[model samples]
Target: MTHRIQLAGHRWVRLVTRLAVVLLLATGGLVTNLASTAQPAYAHAYLVETSPVDGEVLASPPPAVRLRFNEAVSFNERSIQLLDTNAEKLAIGTPGHVDGKANTAQVSLPTDLTEGTYVLAWRVTSADSHVVSGALTFSIGHPSATAAPVEQDAHRAVVVVDAVGRALAFLGMALALGGALFVAVLWPAGRSDRRGRRIVWSGFVVLAAGTVVVLLVQGPYAAGTSLAGVFDPDLLGAALSTRLGHALLTRLVIVLALGVAFGLAVRHGSPPATTGTATTATAGAAGAARRIVLPAVATVGAVALPLTWTLTDHAQTGVQTWLAVPATSLHLLAMALWLGGLITLAACVLVPAGRRETSRAITLEPALPRFSGLAQVCFAVIAATGVYLSWRQVGTWAALGATDFGRLLLGKLAVVLAVVGLAAGARRFVRRRGREPLGVDAAPAAAVRRLRRSVVGEILLGVAVVSITAVLVNTAPARTSYAPPVHTTVPVPAAAAESAAGLQDASIEVNIEPARSGSNVADIYLTGPDGSLVAVPEVSGQLESPDRDVPALPVTVTAAEPGHYVANSMSIPFPGEWVLRLDIRVSDFDETPVRVRFTAR
Candidate 1:
């Protein structure tokens, strides 16, 4: 009889596992299709180059300061400032995008300028709506006697508070959602259990507290001000004016509604009741009213809560956002169900937290099998959504080892795998105990104790996963990890263009790749007076430094296309200002020569 029962159980488990696999595959295919139809977008932008390069010394004040980024940027005019060594702000025009260039910002400066070191601090909003800021120093005439560093203490405090607030909010939501799902769907007895009610209430409190802290910190964070500036009305106004701020405000409102709905759903025998129930002692009409009103309100609040997280985080800005947003929401909901349910199971059923003066009316046997099935379903959804999100966020295998975000994701995956393994072990104990008699015995007691220990271990691993996720959201996506340093562009004067030769009235443009000492490629562009490309029969160049008396290095130029010439190999032995002279022969009869000066260091 025992052998037959074991075989039957094994067959049932096989069927359920197969069904989970099928469901995951179907869902994954649908998400992929949705992503293919969504709009194209990028992640974060990186600053690639800047005008008046950092640590540069200029003889005259530049008319305008410029910044060049790898991805297109939207300037934040209020965050741009030029401060002197004494920390005094200088007069400057409003920053604007350069004509025909979305990736560059230019701001004009006052004509009259004194000699001293100055810091140019700027902040801009990226294409994805994330804020980025940086500072660089340039000396006017000569280095200053005393230069104050850029302010940073305010920024550091904001980062700390934001991180803490985000973590707390996520944890609280998971506990609340998971605990409520467990009580409503699996353990109806939990509706009246004090311990279960407390678990759900705690989640509500933590989430509410976290929301307030985040809202308070947003003001100072955006203004880059000190902690005391959190109350500044202008700073608060800046924070509330953005799309992210609107999402946060909506979250607070959702929390209030959730509290009311949850209170009705959980507090039994009250005029309102959760778990779709009413007080037995109450009159029939009141009981019927309680049954209809409370569950509907609770259901709406539960579904709307996770949507707030989806709108504010990486999902809103990531690639294929149409698919990403829903995938992330489902992932969060599944995680809450799995992790939160495990906690409920351990506390209320498996271990029975309170004193067991006598066996309670509720038994663990009925709840265990139902929880097992629910957990399997939740894990399936999590696994499927996790795979989709990983592909969306970290596109390449190289990024898995190279970027901080990728590494954190890898760590989270490992912990979850361990948790799954422990869960499988507990499931085996359940099956083994099932084959034996139903009453309590030495063997049955041992199995139940071992299963509880495994469940506890899974809960600990779940906490680690949540903590890593909080940090990962703040990190930049790996796609924009590498960027080349900024280089100077020198447009040689047309007066020096050897006129009367075939190359008459032609202009020359030489761009040095990386513009640094060592092997580099020099791309020479030739244009006519009409701004059209001028084809040349022959072109050659040489790199030399008059100050250092460096030996002239010959650079051979090959025609890539009409008016485009490239030198495959141009070697620079040392750092210094190097002059590149391009000799162009438009025809056999005319030879045109032009020269431009640029720094290599």
Candidate 2:
């Protein structure tokens, strides 16, 4: 009877050991899946090239300004605009129309215009619905303008790519840590029970694989090159030379070292021989503690790796950066733990039993409670961190609808809510009572099946979240394009008076000469009652014809020598009849509003 009892005890130990190994392998597979799926390929829109090249000096203004993008763009309100040096509004003839079925927009410019320097301002809505806008200044002649070029840095891209890679790394760490914890807490004491050792080995292999991928891919990615360029020594050297690169390299070394230490522990610290009750308990505790240490170290390293990247890459100061880093870190870790745990539970606890056709032999009886606890923690972390991250990225409540980033975030949140509902269902099932063959009440087999299905649902939703996140990081911030308005002023001259048959002051001869090409200049030469030229001090006007309510044209008048005042660089808003109300300040005469109609071309 004593020998039979000992043999049954050994069998039970062996069974639990196998279960643990399978769980670890499953979780490792989850980490691998995340590593493969969560790559940063779908983020922001890229500008391929531009016509009348950015910052190129043109002798004459181009008929239209064209911008080509890698993806389709949205033509919404305030999508594109053109402004001249004097802050006078230049007409953007029409909305952006598709160029020959390609993703490009051509905005037409006015034909007749005196130009010194003009700024082409554009706002393009990326295919992902993120709006990106910038200004480029080009001179007509040798004139100088004080506008600077917009700078584009690879910092955001690096952060996004590194985040995805570190997410995978964290997944591996969680699997290894959780597996180690399980092994320590429930160590089987039998020579045949080699499951704990197998799990530890599998975890190490996953960690090593994830580390290699990150180390290899990060170099080329940092250099803004494709995967094929990863092996280039120059690219690798540049990446390693930077602060971000060096930190990532250090993380890789630490992870590899941890893997090595885990392997050593597994080899030299096998469970002690289980001779009797006291020996079995002592052996189990020792084996469990040994298994636990390696994963704990791995978890610490994984958490630190992402934290380092976040600190070095995110430039926001004070509480903003602090809040963003921790929230993002927790968000990443929770995703890994939940996804990795699901995989472990499925592969180790479910697949083997199903394969062996002994569905009842390795029942969900012992595994459900542990999984439920893990799921609860995962949900809490995902929710809390997700809320914090959304708050940081979307500053205003209206931004949720105003910007593309906020919209995608909303979609991700909805999916997460659904996942939470599914988890709730699983929790309910585990708590319910059911009959057992041994006369002990336990969770029904059907409940376990439902729990598995819920986990799968959670995994699918998690994938959607990753995809959304991948695209969100590429978009520009919501508040970048809305800059304050600029305002300026200019002067207009009167038309030269013509000699009539009886009245000499009836006719005025106005010579409209552009001081510079692409600028609005109207010169008016007026003959006074005494046959002397008079200077018009101020001129107020409106473009009256096809379009009304044109911008206020600023006019400035200068005396060419003495009597003749030359109006130079007077801005005209559009092509129409412009009524000039000139306040003629001649000697001691009353300020007169002289209305004159002139057509602008």
Candidate 3:
């Protein structure tokens, strides 16, 4: 009788161990699959380049101003505008029209006008529905001004998409990992415990469902489609062609493989006594084989998911470049362990069982210590890696306050802190009570209940963290600037040509040189004759032949130095030849008209 009893006990232990291993495999596979599926969301839209360069001092204004974006922009006239120094409208024809082929916009200006300052104000609605805008200044007859505006729509959209994808990946990982840990520690003793089975199965279902959502949503989000156009094939194809898409595809394959592994484990994990001796032994061995094989496959999948992302997504050069790829990988792994572990604990361990023997001895008692230890290790890994990744991505302390990316990161940190607090409380409760069950005692029941609640809370916060992460990925780093500054020097002559009468014929020489400040601004210098600085006064002047009757446009000239005048706020009225006549008064000469002609084209 003793021999028979021992044999039965050993068989039962084997069956339970097999079930636990299967669950662990499933968890690992699900996390790897989901992690691969997640994509990065951009926060701001990026402008590739522009014409009539920001702050450019053109000899003559072009027919229209053209701006190009990295991605498609929302089409709305109100979104793009042009104004003068006094904030007057200068966009001659229409606000702007999109160039279908280039994915750009063109805003036309009026034909004839006097020299003056002009402002281009633009607002664009990105494919993601976020609105972004900026302003630039340009001058006429002066050096090109470089004053590129700071625009964030395209970049912001990308960041937001990235955050969402990462968060979903994290959430899926947490569910799968937590579920696996529970089954690994508890199911070995309670393979037939209905509640324990439900927990494990439920986690699998949630993980699979989450993975599906990530796969479907990621492609559209990355391509910057409107919410309504998310299902467009062109956008989807474009997204898939990028590195992010390939990573997601790899993740799907891993997840499907894991699902198959889980099914195999469950198939062989029957109650020991339900089958004949020969069948039971065969099933037991098969189950054991699957346990090893599935988890091994899952481990490979996990490694591949992050490795692909590291090689394809992040920048791999500079002082902190070496750390970027490794830190990102570690960050992903830690998140998976923490989230997956919690999910498993809630679904497999803490759930109530029907029979006292099944609940206490088979499920709760054996699983508690194992899960507690695993949770501790996962928490440590998460904390260590999170710190390193945060440091590299965020850089300076001020970035937290100065940039959108940093702010989103800070929000994620807050969520993590809350999860840690809940986890700590659960750990303390588990430690205080020994694994041995108190017969009919409510203390163990209460502790299990508390742990379940804490795990659930952690999952909720994890969701928010993911959302913020998506937003951050789309936005440009706070330190990144798209526009450059403007620089110019204008020299005027000092001598005047006077008639015999009091009236003077002032021959003024206006020297203009336009240079770019940065990527956006155009700096131009305009000097008059008489070897003295001359300003483009806010008055109307006629260009002799081609633009004879055009009114003098508003001009704003700032004195850069003692004898140099920089024209920042001005626009050439026409592109053709024009004779300029400036009326001025020197220290000793009466007011005189200085005439000069230059081709604007």
Displacement of residue 15 (Cα, Å) in model 1 is 44
Q: By TM-score, who's the top model here?
A: 1
lDDT of 2 by residue, 1-601 (tens): 4455445445544543443354344334333432342222112334544565444566786788777655554443245566676666677777566546336777777876565767776655343223345555556664455543332233454545555654455445555555444443322221122554465457656655655565665554544345665677765664554434444555555555545444544443344364777556655654554456444545555465444334333212113654666677677667756665555555555543556445335656455556667778878888888777666566667667666766777887888788788878877765553234432125456655666677778767766665565555545533321111111122222322221122235323455532111234555555555555544443333322234533333356666753454556554432334555454543243343455555443
Question: Residue 130 of candidate 3: its Cα lDDT?
Answer: 36
Candidate 2 to truth, TM: 0.50
Once all C-alphas are superposed, what RMSD does model 1 give against the true structure?
A: 14.5
- Error (Å) of candidate 3 at residue 348 is 3.6
Candidates ranked by lDDT: 1, 2, 3
Write down the RMSD of all candidates, one decimal each: 14.5, 17.1, 12.7
TM-score of 3: 0.55
lDDT values of the candidates?
Answer: 0.68, 0.52, 0.51
Q: Which tens-of-lDDT digit does each residue in 1-601 have in candidate 1?
A: 4344444434433433343344334334333432443233356555556677655568989898888776566554566789988898887999888895777898998778789888888776554445566776777899787665676334777778877787778788877888877776678688878887788788878887777777778666655666886787776676665544555666666666566556656655533332322222233443443465445545555555666666555676656787888888888888877887888878888774355436574367656777777778888888999999888888888778777888888999999899889978876666666676772222455666777789999989998888887777667765444123223434434443554333356667677765554457878777766677767788888766768534455666899998889987675544557788787675577665666777763
List residue ranges in candidate 1 displaced over 4 A: 1-41, 48-78, 85-108, 115-117, 124-131, 136-155, 270-300, 352-362, 434-443, 482-601
Q: Candidate 3's C-alpha lDDT?
A: 0.51
